[model samples]
Target: MFQSFTPLNDKVRLCQGCDLPIRVQQELPYGKNAYCPRCGTQLSRGGSPSLSGNLALAITCLLLFIPAFIFPFISIHLLGVTFSATVPEGAWNLMSHGFPLLSLLVLFCSVIAPIVLCAALVVCHLALHKHWFTGMKLGTTIIYRLKPWAMIDVFLVSVAVACFKLKDYSDIIVGPALYALIVLQLLSVLLISRVSLRRYWEAWRPEHTFEHQSKERHCIYCHLSQPVGTHCQRCHQPLHHRKPRSLERTLAYLLAASLAIFPANLIPISILITNGQRLEDTIYSGVISLFNSQMPGIAIIIFVASILVPMAKILGLGYLLVCAHWRKERFQRQRMKIYFVVKVIGKWSMLDLFVISIMLTLVDRGQILDFVPGIGAIAFGLVVFLTLLATESLDSRLLWDNHPNSPTSGRSINER
Candidate 1:
């Protein structure tokens, strides 16, 4: 039922390494790699079902999406009076306090984004099941479009920070809903990974069936038939072989984030004083006080999320860039592990921001022990924001794309 298509200048190419004539076979399966028999250089194939897994992930995300929205994310207790707020409640509280901008941000990140992402996933999955490829394509497109909105990781970190900030003023209790929200966020991430579009598309396209008969030349490294001796643009070497920049870009971002972390921690996220005259502290000071107050467990968490995690991310990304540039192949595998950790943990830096928002919304003492955002909070927020951008901007494929034997010049052959 398929038609044979041919390139205008089809030709048989000789492998530079092996000097063997190369044949262009018609209809290679999508994502399958081939190589020269003599030198074992790679070849490229494309086309796969892009929407199937993403559709399933979207559906599952919808199931978890409900509890995340309805549950109370946190509870606050002050002066023996307890108050609770869900994601929406927190936003409203921010708005009521004349911090409309903060409220809107809270609403968007904590509530709206997660919900929309779940909905988009469900739509994409359903389209794929019906064999509506166009619909599936649109769904995948929407999924990418909505990915930035799923900020549950950010929200969760914020919740942790908020809990730390509230410890001194009165008894703080983490609500059931807050735990549920965390679970939902995790599930959402899992769903996104499961439905990776690239994997699916590589499997769905039709295979080619015809073979080219003209004389041609193929790269010695990657076995693609080139017009003659041409270099792979991605690897920037002579056409004979393939393999694979900027430490400066990574370092620039790391330095920027590091500079921002100072203000983020110094900013007065919230102040608590026993009976209005005992103590005042920002997030950093509060963590110290927590340790001093014999609460080492909470102190450790604060130290990790607020201090260690962010620094590790910056340092880790920097290291990955440096190592990759230097071609330190011994620890090459370690780079992948580090990249995964950085991507996963970068959002947690926003925990401080979440805590500040929650504290400002939950605690109000009419100037007795007021909660006002410090300049450091804004700086810290910028640091987290920029760092997340930096992490995303980094191309993880760089870690694996440089193998001398990789096909398509190490450009991802799969288009899913």
Candidate 2:
């Protein structure tokens, strides 16, 4: 009953990564994958990806959510006093401290986004399974949009870092919720990677497969070739040759991130007061402090995720933007590689923020050992968010638009 979209031999599949139009095999063997000849982006993988299996995975994640977020996640014991908080409680702690923005951020990323992502996938697969097309499209959109922001895995990593940082001063207790969260994170990863968006689009409208001969126009989302200026029949997005205003938007985000990065690194991100003596730790100073505490490994991670990554994203995105704007052809492959790296590592930079959120809940004993967030935390969080936007807004296709050997280089505005 599950009919796969089998394209004609002459049909062209557009690479969403670099926008290269490639003529792929009509039916690839199971367990094999096709890669774009130019940019090496995975074009298609051969498998009977089941809708029911994906639905089951999503449902399991949804059920696991209660234990992952509701119950005690982690606890700390210091000075003969014990304090424990759930995932949501940590966010609430931040909100109670007047940092509502960061609190909302934690809630959105750790709670709302994951819930929405799982729910969306469940609905999408169910709609497709039941042949109910109406909600399928909306579900598909929500799933992809929420995937990046669902930082359950990142938050878990942050938990590990938090544990490491606090182990020296306190007895850290791992709760059942932490184990549930870990399991939830693993399942989420598998579900996301397993459910191919293109596969869904193909299954939704098998007739829209690349049956046409014209390579002039195509839909980047569903990869269906269509007439000029028409919306994609499958995904309903406008058929643009390139994402409109890609470079300009990328530049704006990068500029804003660049401005924020300074204050983020210069000012103290957190303040610690003990016995009425105060000490402030900037981003750099925090790394050094971690090193002084014999946590060189964590210090390096903090340095890379907090300090090095933000700077690299700004500089890397700027380089790509300049090259794309001027249509520079040399090292287009290398540029694409840089873009991929920037996109992947964008979320991990929030490690410090997550660490701070956990630390606040653990070390607030008032004058004996109080940890208060500083203005720099706000600026640093902004840098993470803005860079993520910059990475998403820039069209990778633009990088290939000016290459001499590029398939889409000659034509300025017609397809995909």
Candidate 3:
């Protein structure tokens, strides 16, 4: 039900989602947005092209990042003993407990990625604003590459889930770091949403109208239109009609995720030793335990984020690959929608991993109460990371390439 816009001039953009060319005005009116008429990928959002606002927000986040990780995030009290946990402490504890992969995953997603994003933004915007061309491209590229991995908001949600799971057995104390983290999460979200590689590129150099040609490539990284078989003039990445070896790479990641997911769900993800008794919980059993503890809502949240989201990504990506490989043109729009959902939800699957990290820090009171990450946590974390890679590697544009009615087929797909 999308309305098509007529191409008014030679100013064209390739929709990253659907791989169709969209003719658009060079700049949109303030506060308006443009979407792909065929598949609904946002092509442009209206706003000032200024870099100062983004620079300010990025600097603020960098300033706040210290206290958010250094101070105690939360305190747990059980049986007259109080223990506090910080973000860095949780990661270090996981590493010390021999789950180095899990610890690094938590540290990167919660600490390192956000810091990189903020630091990159600060450098990129400052370079662009001051006309320092030396590091602008590299800085901007890093920002886009690392933005999806920055999960401050998701980590905050995991914090709440961890508290919910522990409240029944322990008194929880919210700490100053938690408040700072909340603000950091909010600012991070705002800064990430406002950033666009396309806009930044345009700010650095205004878009130029290029002649339409039979062999043209649109740079996915910087959204530049250039000749096929040449590197993008803006970002300098090699251009391709479609992602080279897109199907093969997608299938590989999906197959690996498929193999890892079974052990992830069936094996114990967490272990609790309390009162001289040992208890291990698989993903399924953990959800059941939450339900039995009368926290059905948190159970459902964990179920969807941990169990269902991974399955959906694998199944959904597998189906899309099959269709795209066979040139099955039916339901291309629906498939695009599925791709978007899979991409967006892939990060949430790490919620369980983050929760495990938090629990490891909160409940290590020696023999009285202790939590350990089980073998399944590593597999689950791998599954999440692999699925994220699969989603990123799969080029959605490939689905439209072989369709006879698509724009690539010499038919104007946007025409009514």
Candidate 4:
């Protein structure tokens, strides 16, 4: 059941690339892209979206997620002993082993968030072009907000990497859940992204057009349109054209993460105890060990996730902040592109942390191969968390404010 929200007099949009607010002109034909006149960013490509297709993918993803939870993901056999754990089982094991925080983190990233995200999309797509369910707007808003927190793909990669790491000393078997998890990744992506911008605009139902001076507002959280100072009629969140305290909060987070990266890199992330021989591994030593172990691919993955990503993110955000503060209108589009890349990869940088968590949970059996968490683990995790907050705190709208034509660009984008 779906229902429409309050009617509007203007179709206000915040550019995904530049955040410049403007009215949608006549709907373009399917497959044609409309670029922003101010920043040359492709605003939207016209198309008739298949709500049915999205619904099918969401349903399929839900089916697969069930098996991904039930089937044992990995079996490691050593001597005469065999141990296996499913996704939720692993989280429970982590909790039973006294790491409740990591357990909750694993459960949310792999299970709860993915399920809610897919379920939300199904509801939103079913409610498309008309609202019948009071939860449509709330559900859709949750999908957008939860997408980043769903780490099924990253968790799958971690599981695969864990199996490979265990293969040297133990018999390794990938279970049915891993396969289901893989396919779920593909379909779940469609569930998350298949809904077109055109469908969102149409379903939300703003007025067909309006004067450039109408002073409309767009919700940053839900992307719903409203007039200035009014609550978002759809999602009920207070309206802010851009994130509040955007630049100041972003800079604060950037500085804090910068302080953290040094110790996070310099200290051991986890300690290894094999047959009672103790070894400490800094992040660099771990990557070096992976290379020495002839697992260059895994080593490269760890290096990128642990070393390169954080450094790049720190530098990238600092550069974007400096450019914004300096009002260097040059390369506005390029800056926006950089911002997007940094934001997307911020979560993936947690791959090392996930790997450590998995090993800590699974390998604590009588020192055959035991892994224990280290102090630097906290520092490293903070770096990842802070960078994520920094990215969210940034307001892309600031990028266009200094442009020479930005003042008149809203009206100009209407024609383009």
lDDT-best of 3 and 4:
3
Badly placed stretches (over 4 Å) of model 3 are 1-9, 209-215, 405-416
Candidate 3 backbone collisions, by pair = none
* Model 1's TM-score against the true structure: 0.64
- Candidate 1: how large is its RMSD? 9.4
Looking at candidate 2, the ten consecutive residues that score lowest on lDDT are: 407-416
Runs in model 2 lying further than 4 Å from the true structure:
1-10, 207-211, 365-367, 405-416
In order of appearance, the predictions have TM-scores of 0.64, 0.92, 0.93, 0.86
Worst 10 residues of 3 by lDDT: 407-416
- The top-ranked prediction according to lDDT is 3
Question: Residue 94, candidate 4: how far off, in angstroms?
Answer: 4.0
Q: Per-prediction RMSD in angstroms?
A: 9.4, 4.9, 3.3, 5.0
Arranged by TM-score with the best first, the candidates are: 3, 2, 4, 1
lDDT of 2: 0.80
Cα RMSD (Å) between model 3 and the true structure?
3.3
Q: Count of backbone clashes for each model?
A: 30, 0, 0, 7
lDDT of 3 by residue, 262-281 (tens): 99999999998877889999
Model 4: per-residue lDDT, tens digit, 1-416? Answer: 01112333255565655656655555777766677665566665566666678778878888887888888777777667776667786567656766666667667777899899878877776665466455676666777677778887788788777766677867886778778988988777766656553365356564343333344465664554445665765556777756778899999999999999999989888788876788888889988988988999988888898899999999999999999888887888788888878978987876776676667656755747776767787788788878988987788777766766344434535333
**Tens digits of per-residue lDDT for model 1 on 196-232?**
4433332333212123433233332223443334553
Clashes of 1: 30
Clashes of 2: 0
